[model samples]
Target: MPAPSILSPRDGSNIDPRSLLSSIGEVVYSWDIHSDGLQWGPNAGDVLGRIPEAALNRGLAFAGLVEPGSGRSRYDAIVSSGGHDHGDGVVYRTRYAADLAGRKMWIEDAGRWFAGADGRPATARGVLRLERQVRDGELGAAGNDVCDRTALIERLEQTLGEHLPAERIIVVLIAAIDELTRLNDDFGHEATDEIITEVQDRLRSVMRRRDHLIRYSSNRFAILLTGCPQNQVEMAARRFSKAVGQTAIETGRGIALVSLRIGAAVAPEFSTQAGALIAGAENALAGAKAGASDTAVIARRRQGRETRADEPSLDVQAVAALNERRVRLALQPIVDAGTRQVAFQEALLRVGHGMDGPFFATAELIPLLERRGLVRLFDHRVLELATEFLAADPRLTLSINVSPRSLIDPEWLDAFLGCTRAAPGMSERLIVEVTETATIADPARMAGILKQIKDRGARIAIDDFGAGHTSLRHLRAFPIDILKLDGAFTQNLRRSTDDRFYVRTLIELARHLAVDTVAEWVDDELQATMLCDWGVTYLQGHLVGRAELPQRGDASALLHATG
Candidate 1:
């Protein structure tokens, strides 16, 4: 207000005394110099944590506040410089400890000197800011928001400077304020405020004196642990997780437990820059919250070479090589329980290195293809191979397992139909088997897709029918021509009377719906006889035949066994 201070250099001015002051001080500080003992604004008192009158009373003199050894020399240099005309400007830094609210705090004073018209050195005014906070063992009650942020920053810088010189630091923030939301909804705003206040108190108790903790959002709090290594960050995260898990706060009505999902990102791993470090940590936290697990999710910048070890490895090149007409087909006979005559044969897809090696079954190959999103490709190939296999044996009916994903894809459907068209009577002989779990997830969609396949003269069968939560509701909702009961339900029929009863009920239900039923995992002749007695249309398991590639001569053996 007093002639608007102009110690700051003009724009593009060659002189920069501020840079020198910044470099010399432990913390950043700046001042405006003018032609007076100290041309300072009233706000300078606020920066120095003192009243303007009291600060002015102690002005321009080396007091007991400054260290005796260095303080005297600095004062002598300033007085002798009389009027420093190095023309850039006068800048100096002095360290001191000031009594702040009955506690001593280290401060750095940075100021510039200006000359008066009399050619005499005049005012040297600037900021005397707290740079380091010394904490006595007194633990203040929480919810105070009274802690000095600048002092906290200073302490964090000092502590971290000794441990590690991090290029960047990231702090993960995880919090649950569901209790606050529920409180606000039930009670008035007053109760909600109290809950939030309590949450702040709880958070403060867990944090260190140097850590920067802030209300990141209304429901979330953030802690910035400067120079924290990735491992230490993880350890801290786990401790916080355990603490949160153990805490229960009373909200008048009842006690509410808080939950948290933690995510972490390390500096230089995610980013070297401080701002980017914060952002990456936030992203990792989001991922943790999205995942189903309760444990903290730790993430780092994904290196170019990083790969998930848990995911099944697929050799794309090897799979691609086999994509060309290099697949094989096998048929397991589904016999009519009453007649013991071959009713149909379920065609199984197989992959082999060559004619001599062991063949990979449809069960094994299908999962691999699905993981690679190549199920449609494998499905189409199986359909083509089945069509060719069936064409040679015109009287035999063939069932092929189709992955749910493949059946849902419109492109795969068209490709499948095209392959069927190439082999005459292929659609009439084909049966499509889909898993119970896949069907349950989207029953309406599965029904519609299966209807399309049925319209082309192909039969539909539900595989692993009793394996999941498949109830009569599924049967009534979707039209399945065949139900293949899971082995688990039928395997121990003799051991458990309850198992026998459930199997009988399932068989009776299938018969009422006019849906043919097949029993899988019929390990022994005893299981097979029991299943046949229950009126199962077909039976398949170890007793019948293991899945194998079909050869020209195998047809005679299959026919002989069925006959």
Candidate 2:
């Protein structure tokens, strides 16, 4: 469908554009560049606030209607009085004058520049859509309960738009109380509310008189700091983090220690759009939560609105995709080096439209899942699917990858243990593999989780072992059943003596630790032969058996081929 043309003769139009737009939940507006006056459509009052009939008759100028600091320069640069043809469009949020009811309103204005007769930019005519409005009294003293999320965002946008030119940096921090929902479930809503109130009070106490603190949602807070140096901003983030992290809130239930995941973004000098700042902060917050607890990350500039692999973060669609259960397993056999028999198959996740359609690799999906705090959910689903596969094929022993983030999630770990417990002897046939680098955050906690899984008869493997910063100390800490040598070590084993020696040393260390060693990416007979000579128990790669979507009819044949 073609988009409706906004350039339909400005004068002598039989159909009223205002009436047309109002019918579709919009308001038609025009800015006369020469006079600097903004002409509002009939329905503008509905969106912009109930303007007095006298003010509407007098004609409201653009400067008077728009908040002083909001996009004035862009409006001046884009909408020219010289009548030049520039096919440029802008989307921004702005504040307009109050209605008769004396309430401030925020509206999103999006419009394209149009040329006058002289071929110079003359005016910008666009639509005004309401975002949110708040009465002046709503933003009471700091002592009162903070403004709602919508109103707080509106004020932040207004403040940013107003102050961008000052060249002063404003730090926007988005603090999300970690696992607030779990608190609600465990302690009850009353306790949750009390904890939230106490946290808010603590935040208020920590903030300066000039700083603005808002209860962004049930579990998040938005903070705006003006005129703070970069060092001070960093210190402030750490300060708030420590204050919240160390203290325990006294709810009716008991003392509850709450952690915060904070994301901070400095206001861009070139642009002060509140949405951009919030988005940057959001991305940073996600990064902090994905890795170490009580951490802070500075926001990076995004290329555009949508997030892709090349971009710095994930988007709403990617986050939703992880939760939709549109994933399937692709099985690859891990063969015994000497006997050339199938030891087990690794179940890799493929996400897409259907079984045969194009799908995203785990490489692409992992970052997105981690960013949105959905890795645990994805891991949980993978386990569920793996269990189904195991149930269907009693002879099959499967190796599945688990995220370090999921291991730290107490609820997910408990549920996973429960699932493994349900099938009494199923754990013996399951191998849980975790990347070596992923255990860097808190090895003690990860080691404990691995121990619990091991106790249930499941074997734990330190996958990609030689590729990361794994040490002898870590080997001693973790109760690992297998050490999967990284493909990097075996990929060059045939050519490099150092690679061969490293693999030998790792194998000897594994032997001493009483752990089996598996060499990955043993693609050829030569690599397999060499790894086998080093006493590596298992070998995995394309040469052994390429990963395939498991079909019921081919299961027996696959086993025979490996045998």
Best-performing candidate as measured by TM-score: 2
lDDT, candidate 1, 86-143, per-residue tens:
2223433334444544545655444444343223334443344455564563123222
Q: Give the TM-score of candidate 2.
A: 0.44
For model 2 the local lDDT of residue 244 reads 80
lDDT of 2 by residue, 458-513 (tens): 99998866532555667789988998976644665654454555566566667667
Candidate 2 residue runs with Cα over 4 Å from true position: 1-324, 552-561
lDDT of 1 at 63: 34
Instruction: State model 1's lDDT.
Output: 0.55
Enumerate residue pairs that collide in model 2.
83-119, 83-120, 83-121, 84-119, 84-120, 84-121
Give the worst 10-residue stretch by lDDT in candidate 2: 80-89
